[model samples]
Target: MQTSKSTTRIISISFFTLALLGCQSAYYGALEKVGIHKRDVMVSRVESANETQLEAKQQFQTALQKFKSVRQFNGGNLENIYETLNDEYETSAALADKINSRINDIESVSDALFEEWEKELSEYTSESLKQKSAQQLTKTKSQYRRLIRAMKNAETSMKPVLNVFKDQVLFLKHNLNAQAIASLKGELNNIESNVATLIKQMNKSIDEANQFIKTMSQ
Candidate 1:
């Protein structure tokens, strides 16, 4: 009877040890699976974020190019006026305002959080320009054509400008400002010459656009 009791105790201990080992194996397997799942989730999230950022960057770059083209045109228009009547300061101010407004639009659109700002900017420009007499519309259109011509000229002269812009982008990427406002005065003068030519072309286009609107209204 004593021998039977001792054998029974040994069997119970063996069974408990096997059961504990089985539970530990299962726990470790579950932890490994959880770790793998977590890793996959993190990878997916990182890929998604990278894609979003890349797309945003591409869009911003395209938009910036278009904006620069427009600016070149506007500068040409201002240049014509400045050349005809040396009102450098006034022209500079106007161009500065225009550039700032465009930059704001670009920045707002580039950032996902500032999308609403882009919408407001569009609304503001549309509304502000909506109320115009036929003569004013005509003049605006003429001005737009002039601006376009200026842009074309600026584009032609843009080998150096392009280089500068590329350098500026690199600097901006590193959170640096490439040129000071005072320094930009000279650059603006050079830019103005190109812009003046574009402005003439743009003015004509604007006139045509306005005329089309008028016709549609009729």
Candidate 2:
């Protein structure tokens, strides 16, 4: 009877040990499944982030292209207009300088950002990227707007100066007497002074606008 009792106790202990091991195995399996699920979620998030970056990059490219096209058109028109005007007014030189300055400013920003953007785009594969590409794009567009404004102001200021020069030249051409010629020369000098002042103001405005654009781009 003692032998029977001892054998029964052994059997009960073995069954309890097996049951405990089964519970541990099930717990570990459940933990592994949870870990795999978390990994999948993380991977999905990373993919989404990459997609967002790509989309932002495309938008930036489009904006930049548009800016370039408009800039070229404005620059060409300005050149043609300046070339048609008489050189005596001294307006073309100042206008050309302003236009060139603006073109340089625009090119500097677009070229630098374009290179940086290409580099950043290649490395962007996650959603929590360090680079804020969209903000950069918006800033670039704002810079372009400032450049356009500066060009327009320069053009507008030049018109009045050209008109005054034209009127004075026409007057001198018609009134050829010595006294009339002397008086017309004096009048032309005064018109020239006014033109100089306008050019100075236009330069200041262009400088301020360019500086503002540079600040925004940075």
TM-score of each: 0.22, 0.39
Error of 1 at 68 (Å): 15
lDDT of 2 at 15: 100
- What's the lDDT of the predicted structure labeled candidate 1? 0.39
**Cα distance off (Å), candidate 2, residue 43:** 40
Assess candidate 1 and give its TM-score to the true structure: 0.22
Query: How many clashing pairs in candidate 1?
Result: 36
Worst 10 residues of 1 by lDDT: 105-114
Question: Model 1: how far is 70 from its true place, Å?
Answer: 21
Q: Please, what are the lDDT tens digits per residue for candidate 1 over residues 41-143?
A: 2233333333332333233334234324422342224333223222322333344344334333322222321232234444544554544433444553454
